[model samples]
Target: MSNVTTKKEVNVFIDYLARCEGETALRLNVDADGEVRHYEVKLFEPPRFFEGFLVGRKWYDAYEVCSRICGICSVPHVISGVEATEKAFDIKPGKQTVMLRKLANLSELNMNCIVRIYILGGPDFLGVNSVMDIAANPATLDVVKMALKLKRLGNDLTDFCTGRETHPVGIDVGRMLKLPDKHKIEPLLERLKEAKEDAWKVAEFVASLKVPAYKRRVPLLAIHREDGYALNYGKIKSTSGFEVTPYKHDEYISHKHVKQSNALFYSIGEGQSFMVGPIARVVLSFDQLSPDAQKMARKYWGGPEWFHENMPFSVYAAHAVEYMHTTDEMISILEKLKAGMDESEIMKEKAIPQKGQGFICTEAPRGLLYYTFKFDENGDVQFADIVTPTAHHVHNLEQDLKHLGPSLVGMSEKDATMQVELVARCYDLCCSCSVHCVTIKK
Candidate 1:
């Protein structure tokens, strides 16, 4: 064994609140070898901390407060939180409400995929510095155009359902503020059909890459529903064959501390590490995908080797499959609405608030997001806990880095750093989701 004590510190900076204002700071840190020897990940008090300040407030207040968790995913957070609160009070929205929520969630997923591919994954795939480079490339301009179309389609769908794309104003306690008539939603369905075709092309292209050879057998956790692959609600199932409802969520998951950062490290059942998100969900719910999606998965990822590897390309493939599935489902739902699903006629019931706990598990763009809220008799939030998928995978990212680092001992620092960053990006770690701040020190 080498006694060099090769220490590495990795720091990921997050400045959501600062950027929301005018001033921004990049938290930094140093990674010794591949280990986070010293680190800080900056978090602000405005949004997440503001949530903690919402104790003793009415249940509806959490919708606006937690919505600020990340500007990108605010809609899902708000809707999911609201839904959970409603469930706690034993209140259920009518048919139109359910349909609208589904539309919004699917729209958000579509937009998120576009952003991930164009802004993040594009540069990494093309070995370029940014999407602008890809856009300028004549050969890849079609891909760029497709990405833009998909993003616009998502925005249109959001507008059709919620009346605005970002920070929508339609959501409320009993029902949404807006209703979708045929004229409003038809154009969106048409656009989604086109977008779904384009997404398949993207998946085919990604599947053509020579995937890297790395496979670690870790427990996969996801939400499984009896009807189909659930995006909005389901029971949490593990690769080890253990399944539990969201109400028993705390029994299966827990978080801890690491030396280098304040962000909580996660483990399951006496150091049994696991992973969640796109890959896990796809693997566990493969049979639940739409027919088109199933065909595409087999077409692209049919080989036995594909099933054995933990390649990042699998994530892209799964994302594309998920996009297709959600789009198809949205179109079907829209067709139902056109066939006489009315928004105004459904009955609404008033719910009495008692001391209760609400639990929810939904698939965010990143993966499974679990939210738990404890409400007092007045329907005021007494306590809250959110378990994000990214948190569950951070330790695995570090482990991959550590394994890859020893092989790069003789290589130049630049080359080694690139390798590590690639691995980190593969996990799609949103340092913003973490509670700690990041800082790099020499």
Candidate 2:
């Protein structure tokens, strides 16, 4: 054998991943000896400019506009945007307001995770092409029904709290424009209580599936709190043993430009990239998970080492655990709301824009969602920046492919391609939110 050089470009189809979130292409270069040399995770979507156009808009318009970033994650974008605005103006929401915001965040996390774990990731575990195919098979039809029912309940909970299901309109900075109806709380809570069994069924279903094994130890970053599982509130903590407030994220996590991607790549200083999302959150905050969720995690995920090891495929398993945890949290919050609604929670105050800067990093269902904003004295937005979770994961996914691609040297192209897709789906990439800016050189 003299020499062999092969190049292949693969476009990830919608059927391979969950609900056609967006498009990403993979380019792999394999050398003559069957060793992989280079890989590029190409993002084709045009630059969205969510951050670019935000300048010159009013401060209050930030969340409403940024919320359009992802239909699946509009709630998280809104919450992050609102929190960033609150920080800029020095507005401190009451405890009830914080609790209700947590409810909103948890509701979306529950909904997004159910979709990813059951409706989306389920087909992969079951070795099927699409969820429709899962429904067509008599053996898995019940699984489909259960997934849909659970998804519906999640949507209802999100809608009840946020106003509309997607791109919700009831929440704003410092106050709730619309509070959840008192009469509806009892019924919603009852439905949530009833869904606990269904939640377990989904988790058990995931636990039964075989997870592809490929391990790597990349820095895992998440928002952490000492008192409880942190979603909206907490300092940024990483598996590397570094803690930084959200304001200093720029000093630690830095963004880079790559010709292969329209989105930017982020690293925690030097050339090392880090992973964020469900896996990071679960690993960093395992101690803070609800007791029931912890029991399920240990039972299904094979104790803590499986997570501590930082296995990429374990992301699916992590999503299942988070689903269980968020359900328990939602029930607890709903019970409190059912007992009585505080007048302060529903009250709204007008925000006076001051010339100041604010920064926030919150957990979206997929992972860390970050936002920073500056306002003029007249309450107009002087500048805005957002770093979505999908953008954060893309580079790490490429790094994972580098580690996994060499293993595919002897396999058939089709089999090798699928293994690649499996890893990508594991990140639950939301491409829509990732492609925010593209570089243009004059």
The TM-score leader among the candidates is 2
For model 1, the stretches where C-alpha displacement exceeds 4 angstroms are 1-47, 209-215, 303-308, 345-355, 435-442
Looking at candidate 2, what is the lDDT of residue 341?
A: 80
Error of 2 at 345 (Å): 3.7
lDDT of 2 by residue, 1-442 (tens): 2112553433223232434477666666565454666776765656778788889999888889988888888888999999999999999887777888888888888887778876667677678878899899998898888888888888888889888889988888888877789899988888888777677787788778786777887889999999988996789998888898877888888887776554477888686888888889899999999887788888887755677584787877787888888889999999998888878656666777788888888999878888999998887888898888887887788888887866666555666677777787887878778754332323
**Per-prediction RMSD in angstroms?**
5.0, 3.4
List the global CA lDDT of all models.
Answer: 0.66, 0.79
Name the best candidate (by lDDT). 2
- Compose the digit string of candidate 1's lDDT tens values, residues 1-442: 3234543444444344111211122233345454433223322332345436767888877766766665666667778787777777777787678778888887887787667656666576577877788889999888888888888888777777777787766776667766765676677667777877887886776666443454456677788887887777788887777888877766777767766644466667875666777777777788888888777778878722354256544666666777777777778878877777664733344346777877778877777776777799888889877666666766665555445544544444554455555555556665455432222222
Angstrom error of the Cα, residue 138, model 1: value is 2.5
Query: Candidate 2: where are CA atoms >4 Å away?
Result: 1-20, 259-263, 436-442
Q: Residue 53: error of model 2 in Å?
A: 1.1
Among all windows of ten consecutive residues in candidate 2, which has the lowest summed lDDT? 7-16
